[model samples]
Target: MIQRAETEHSKELGCAKHLLLAIGSANVIGVSLPASLSSHAGPGAGQGRSVFFSDGVSRIRLTLDENSPVLIENSGETAVLTFDGPGGLISVEGFVEKTGCHCPKQAYITINEGCIFSCRYCNVPNLDKHIKTPDEIASLISDAVRRENVECISLTSGVVGTMQEEDERLFAILERVRPFGLPIGVSVYPTPGLSQRLFELGVSEVKFNLETATGKLFAEMCPSLDRDVLCNALKEAVGIFGKNRVYTNIILGLGESKAEMKQCITHCLENGVIPIIRPLTPSAQLSHFSRPLAEDILSISEFLQSELLRFGLDPSASKTMCAKCMGCDLTPMTDLHLGEVTP
Candidate 1:
C-alpha cells in the first residue's frame, strides 16, 4: 500500500507540473471571485489583478479573465480548474492561495511604478506612476510582518529618474526595513556600484533582469539600456552574492529562438547566475508577440535545470525573490524536481 501511495503521489506531481505550465503559459484564465474577495495587483505595470493557486505540491499565479476557456471554480477547501481538452473538458483540483503581500510568505514591494526607459514589451511606463516613500514602504513591510506569514522582503522598481537616483531611493527604503531583519531581495536596473552596495546592505540576494536572450534582440527591444552594464552587474552579483544567490529573468516568446534561449541559459550558468524562464504576457503594446506553449516552457525549464546542475548552481538554494516564491516562472531545481542535488 505504501508503494502504491508513492506511485500515486508521483503521478499527481507530474500532473501538477503540466497544469502549472499550462496555466502560466497563457495570458489569461477564467476565474470568478466574490466581490468581497480582496484584489491585489502585482508590483509591475500591465499586470492584471492575479491570485495564487496551489495544489498540494506546486503553485501558480494566474491572471483572471472571465472569458477565458480555462475556468476555475471555488470548491470549499479547494478549487476545480476546467479547461477545454482535445476530447472534452478536463478538470484539476487545487486551492486558490491567499497571499499576505504580492505573494505568500513574502512582502514583494515596488518602490516606484514609473519608468523612464521604454522597454517595448513592458507596460510599466504606460501605467499611472507612483513612488512610495521610505516610511510608507516600511509601514507596508511592518504590517505584513505583524499580520501575515511574511518571511522575505523583496523590492523592485521602475527607473523613474536616473538609475543612480533610483538606487539612492532604494537605499533609503532599505534603511527603513533593515530593522525587521528579514532576508531582502532586490531587482532593478543595474547601475555602477549597485551590486557591491546591495551586498553591503545585508541583502540576501539580488536579481538583474536580462529580459531578452541575445544582444541583437536586446538591442532592438531595450535600446535605451546598456547590455554590457547589465552583464557586468550580473557577473559581479554572482561573485559578491555567492552561487545560487544571483538571478536574471529571461522571458520566453519574444521571438527568441530555442537556440537563443539555450545560449542565454548557458551564459548565465557559466557565470554562476540562475536564469528565470518567464513566459511573455501579451499586452496591447506587445500584442504582436505570442505566449509560449506549455511544451516550450517545459523544454526550456528542463534545459535550464540540466545546466544549473552542470554548473554546480542550485535554484532550490535561493532564499529570496522569484526562485524562492516559484510563482511566475518555472524555476530550475525548485520546480522540475528531477533529482536530488549534491550539496
Candidate 2:
C-alpha cells in the first residue's frame, strides 16, 4: 500500500507541470496581492498587474484577478496556492519571483505602446499611444541591467505608424543600446528585408507572431495584416537567425481545433521556427472568447514537445522573448519534462 501511494504521488508531480501551466494560461488569481508585491511598479499597470509564481522546478506567470478561483497566501518563506479542483481543494507551494523588468533576468521593453491596426482581439490598438524616445529607451535598459543584472534585452511594439516608420524607429533605438553587450531580440510586424536588416544590427533573435492557427481565423481576427507576409517573414527569419533562434506565437483558444493547431506547429517546426502555444487572454474586445482548458493546453503542449524533439528544435536555445521567459506558455524543454518528474 505504501508503494502504491508513492506511485500515485509521483504521477501527480508529472501532472503538476501541466497543472501550473493551466493556471497560468487561465491568467487569474482570486485574492488581492499583498502590499509586499503590489507596491512594485511593473508592466501592464493599466490592465491588471501580473505575478510570477515558481515551484522549485518550474515557473508560471499569472495575473492578479479577484474573480479567479485560485488563491495565493504567504507562508513563512513561500506562498500557498490553493484552488478547488474536480476532486476537492488542492494546494501547491511556491514563491512569487520578482522580475527584472517585465520578466526575470531580461529587460523586455516596449517601443510603442499603441497600434494603428485595430485587431479586434488585441487591446493595444485601443490604448493611449506613447512612443519612447531613443534616449528614454537607453536609460530604461541601462537601469534594468544595473539593478536587475539582466542578461538579455527584448524589444516589442505595436505598429504606431507605417511599417517603414516603425522599423526605422526600432533601428534608432537599437543603435543606442548596442554598446550594452547583451543578447538582443526583436518582435515586430515584419516587412520585406527586415530580417536581414536586424541581423546586420547584431540582433541575436527575432519573432513574428502568426497569432492564429488557421488562415481563415487569421483573416477574421487580423483583417489588415497579411498572413502570407507573416509566414514569409518567419521562414526568412529562420534562414537569417538559424535554427532555434527564431520564434513565433501560435495562440490557443482562438476558435481553432486541435488538428489545426498541430498543423500550425508542424509548419513552424518544418521551417525551423519555434512556436509558442500562448493562451488567449480574455478582454472586452474579445469577450466572446474563453481561455482554453488545462487538459487541452497539456495535450497540445505534449504534442509540441514531441514534434520539437523530432525536429531537433529546443526552446532552451532561444535567447530572448516569450521563449526565454517561459512565463506565458507551456514552453517545451523548460516546463515540459519527459518522464523526469518524481514525487
Candidate 3:
C-alpha cells in the first residue's frame, strides 16, 4: 500500500509540473494547452533538461532524468532533487538586477469600503467601511517614516461618499505627511480631473493599475470600470508626474499574450509611464491562479531592463524610483552625461 501511494504521489507531481508549464505557456502565448498534453506521461530518461539565462550574465541549469533525479545549478551552488521526476525543458533570460530597493516603513490604510467600480481580482472585502480619520492616517505615516530607512510613504484609500470628499481626505493626509518631505505614492481609481489634483498635492508618483492588457479582458475582469477613464488618467498622470514618475502595475499569468504584453510595455514607455510587472500569487479567498514560470519572469525583467537602458535609466540609480535605487545616483560624477539625473 505504501508503494502504491508513492506511485500515486509521483503521478500527482507529474500532473502539477505539466499544469504549471501549461499555465506558463498560455500566459505567454494566450492559449490553453489541451488537457491530454498538459498531463502527458511523466518525465522519462533523456527528456528533461532546462537552461535559464538571466540578463545574459547569469546561467542556471536544471536537469531531470529517470535514475539521475533532478539537478539545479546556479553560479555558486548546485542543488540535487531526491524525489520528484524530471520536469521539462524551459529557458528564459533578461532583467536581472544585483540589488533591490529598501522598502520604506509603509502601511496601506484603507479609509472607506466604498468603491465605485468592482474589479474581479481585487482582494478588498466590502466597499462600505468607514473612513479612517486623516489624523490617524497621518500619525501612522509619521511613525513608519521615523523607523529606520523610511524615505517614502504610500497612501491608498477607497472611493466613498462624493469624489470631492475622497479628494479632501487624501489631501488632508498628504498635508500631514508633507512636513517629512518624504516621497508619497497613491493608488487612485481614475476619475475625471482627479489625476491633476493628486499630483498637485505633491504626490511623487501615482499608480492606476491597468491590470490586464486587452480591453476585452478589462471589461470582463473589471465590469464597473470605464476603460476610457483609466486611459485618460494615465495620460494625465504622464503629463503631471512626467513620464518617469508615473508607474503602472501589471500582473502576469492573467491569460495575456507576449505580444499584448510587449504592446502594453511599448505604450507605457511612449507615454512616459513605467510598467511594474509582478507575478500573480494565489489567494485562498480569491481565484486559484498559478504564477508564471521562472523563465517568463526572467524574460519580462530582461525586456524592462533593456528598455530602461534606452531611456538612460540604470537599475542602480535610485531606490526613490520606487525604493529600488540606493545612494548610487548621488555620488560625484567625474564625466557625467548631460540630461542624466542619477537617483
- For each candidate in turn, the TM-score is 0.88, 0.87, 0.61
Query: Model 1, 1-343: lDDT tens per residue?
Result: 0011111122233345544455542222334443212222232245556666666666677766555555566764677665544334455577776665677788888788767888888777776788999999988888778877798999988888876788899998888889998899999888878889998888999999898999998998898999889999999998898978999988888898999999999998898888988887776368676677878888888898888778888877777878888877776655677874675
Q: What TM-score number comes out for model 2?
A: 0.87
Q: Residue 114 of candidate 1: its Cα lDDT?
A: 69
The lDDT of each candidate is: 0.74, 0.76, 0.49
Model 3 earns a TM-score of 0.61
Q: Candidate 3 residues 36-64, lDDT tens each?
A: 11100011111222222122222121222
Candidate 2 per-residue lDDT over residues 268-291, each given as its tens digit: 999999899987766546867667
Score residue 34 of candidate 1 by CA lDDT: 30
Best by lDDT: 2
Cα RMSD, each candidate: 5.2, 5.3, 13.5
Full-model lDDT, candidate 2: 0.76
lDDT of 1: 0.74
Candidate whose TM-score is highest: 1
